[model samples]
Target: MKKIIEGKIWTAVCVALTLLMIVSAIWIGMRYYVSMDIYQTPSMFLEGEYSVDGGEWKSIEKDRYITDHFHKIVFKGKMSKKLLMYFGSLTISSKNVWYTLKTSDGTVIQSYNFDDEKLSYEHTQTDKPLALDMPNTPGYCVKTIYPDYLTKTENITEDSDLIFEVEYPYSYALVSYNDCVDVTAYYNEGMYLRFFYDALPPVLLFVLICFFGLFFFPVASFILGKIDYKYLTFGMLSFLWGLYMIMQQISGYLNLWIVDPTVCMMMDKITGYCFVAAVLFYFKANMSSRGTRIAANIASAAYLSCVFTVFILHLCHIRDLNASSMTMNFATAGSIVIMIVLLCVEMRINRNALFFLLSWVPLLLTVAIDAVDQFIHLPGSHYFNYGLAITMIVQIVRLIGDLRLQYKEAIRHQQMQKELYEAKVSVMTSQIRPHFMYNALTSIAMMCEIDPKIAKEATITFAKYLRGNMDSLKQTGPVPFTQELEHLKKYLYIEKLRFDDLLNIEYDIQATDFVLPLLSVQPLVENAVKHGVGMKEDGGTVRISTRETETAYEVVIEDDGVGFDINEQKDDGRSHVGMENTKKRLHDMCGGEVKIESVVGKGTTVIVILPKEGQPNEDTLS
Candidate 1:
């Protein structure tokens, strides 16, 4: 047990280290190729005066910016000469707000207008394009101050007071920067290439993880059997979480599609809610205690209900999704806290719970940081993305260890079953050999007194029949039907010498193209002649026949002799070893079965049915 645990841990560490090294190598390569030598500086309007709702102007403080809904705030600042000397273009970047750039003479140079009549909330309308100069990433807008555009179009010069009117529905932060290149020049300088490298690697990693979780892991779990449910639930959680991460980077960095900000925002929130619910479901599936599972169930349902309510609110224009984000985060955090407490309880009994704690703790911290970041407006923070990578890596490593253990267990179980089956077959062969030898030798002794020539032939046949039965002791599996039939013919040839005219044998063979257990059918025929026919004063005939059916091949042994009740218990209390052993070996070797139909006054019929599925079809009887 100690060695197994050590091996699992070693494997997990190696895999985790390899994954980290791959990511690090890709990042280093990207950094080497994408140069960060771009010319840029902070704007002169870093300190500005602002007015809220057309009220009196107040001086702006560091890291303190205007934030409100459906309110107009104007910022007034002067463009410096140093910015003009460098032909420096001013860039203003903000999210979830609509504003226009204007000169001191109140001439609007560029406008990104949001129709206030369309929405009761502060979000820009998603029904149509917000404006001509829309950013590819949702909620992100950039306005560049081009040197040529200012002088040619607006005829503005250095130290000009720039009047900015802004209305914020949702605001992150409004920041200004002076750069050497204009908006066109910035894109031409391969800004997209830098963002692609920054975002695509993690997306590719998460996608691969999703493929394993959704497909590979579940297949492994099915083969393992006992741990199937938990693997499926965890797989669902991983897939949904990976999808959420992919969607986060889709429009922002990859820019695969030009999507509305509101649409992207909703998608981000929806996938987040789904994966969180999946997390709760995963806990429920993994929990050993019934009480913990019930608790997890309730938590998952409530979380999904909260998400539904938030969506309803957004759809009805009662409340926006952004307004409910913090509330939802708290709900998610509460579920995580309860799950952690449950994991603590489980860790007391199960060592695997310790591994779960290790994976989840970093995620809990990430969720806490994200809640705080949402409130404080942290710029370009991907704490959740980083934390998710760590958690997924740990969980995947643990899963690989689990699957490896299961494969070993399955192989061990199969070997044990095979050994047990062989032991049973050996015991069955031993039982038939002694009983048949006694009967054949007794018949041969009786025939020697009657005729020397006939007795000599019977002796040779008896010797061959005994040889066949002895050979079966060494046999492991099924033999061709023809082989067993030849042995049966030799047994009957000896029996015919003893019974003479009293015993009559008939054969009606239709099909002889399949395999069955060695020594399986012969015993049934022996019982029919000895017990069924020889019991009467003048013995009756025994007919042996073989035929094919749609689903199986059958050998029938029918005797027109006095039969006994099949349902009655024998007086001796000793079982018929030949019949019972033949039944077992037939079923075990070829998925075949025996059906006995006997009437006390009439006769008996024993049918051996071998299903065609597993039986070999070869070596047709000559």
Candidate 2:
């Protein structure tokens, strides 16, 4: 059970099941509450006729731009019995106007208004579209109140003509009247409930993404104590994008609960601008090339400058913020182009760039499609929200992959460090054997009275040899061959004092400018003196030599004493751990190798080979 809990496959299965449950729940809710009988017809306004200020009547278009809000608009249309039977209510929704419903002969029905006073328009056609001053409250937002029991209304007949007297009296609003209007026909109460329910899942997904971006990632980074700027910027990108997407999905319903509708509009605008800036910041943070980072920085600065300029102009009453929509669109499009180009260039060199491109391109394309749909007043499908969900999933997967790589690398680094430390400890202990120390010190003490001059020399050499063994413990890597040779000579000098003429020493020097693991060669020389020569009655010569090959530098230690069979394992209760550690270190540190050749009653030979710079070790190559 513990192993299953710890396994990655189990975690993946849990996540998949959780996601499936969430999706199934949403689907069940949607299928249960939403009515299939709900349908839409072409807006009734398309068949009506409108007269501006009692002037000539013109056929109403699918969409109308009303530039002359100072005049009254009288819209005339007829209600059919079939239309009234199917739809329980009709909503004439708009942010720019308030209207009264009346019969064609001019009998009043109902009036929708927050205040009775006429609105004052401060500017005319001379200035850009202006934001008029209005009460900063939810009451100021236009509310739709369709008549109850419309099919049974007393004033209505099967072919009764209705008149809509519209006025923009609260403000000098100049905009596409159709942009904010929705002439939706509700069949039943279920339609209203379904309208909000349809948006619930997308809103929930975006909110979850926002929570992770604004709180989870940043807090995790802080706790880890490694401040990765890329994750920070990614979090910012996620937050702004998520907020923007959420607003796009449900900002209309949000107005009903907010203090000020205009504040929501401003927040929406700011989120859009900041979302673009976040993308550039995330790109800059992730870039490895200085040129790419600089490019992203400059692009971000330019985009921010445009956003600030638009806001400044809006605040100064030079222009309304909505009037600069074209400029904002161009800026957003330009940033998209730049990002696509950068990603294309980076994809050739960076593997992660492909993932980034995959995540971003679909979002860009879906947003463009949704933007076009909104601009044309098409029914909302909001494919961009799906794109956002995909982007979030991809980014999460990418982060997990990076973390896995980091974990593996950290484990590998620790393992290598452990092996290196153990190698150093093994070589140190082998060099400072208690028996060799006792014999050398005993020889020195006996010689102190027999020959004081020789005794003093041997004492200093012994001290130096002991110092070398201690120093080897501190070394983490290979040392120069000359340094190892000097340390080895100190050990040999002390050994000669103990084993007088019985132990012979020889040196064949040809190469001295190479490096090997610290104390590497000295251990083999000690093995020769102790195991090969000292066991014989007539102690023989232990020869140390170095020579340069075409591709390597070699150190050879040979002893002309009783040599044991190379294939035979000695069972003298002795562990040859030092030999194994030396071989391991040689291969790990410098790709070097060790070879031994011995025959019973003959001499033994040990060779160490280290590759030359820029040359592959022959042992590794084979």
Q: lDDT per residue, candidate 2, 33-71, as tens digits?
A: 766557442345324787776788877655344333333
Candidate topping lDDT: 2
334: Cα error in model 2, Å:
2.9
Worst 10 residues of 2 by lDDT: 119-128
The candidate that wins on TM-score is: 2
lDDT of 2: 0.69
Model 2, residue 339: C-alpha shift (Å): 3.6
User: Which residue pairs overlap in candidate 2's backbone?
Assistant: none
Tell me each candidate's TM-score: 0.55, 0.62
Model 1 CA lDDT for position 603: 88
lDDT of 2 at 606: 98
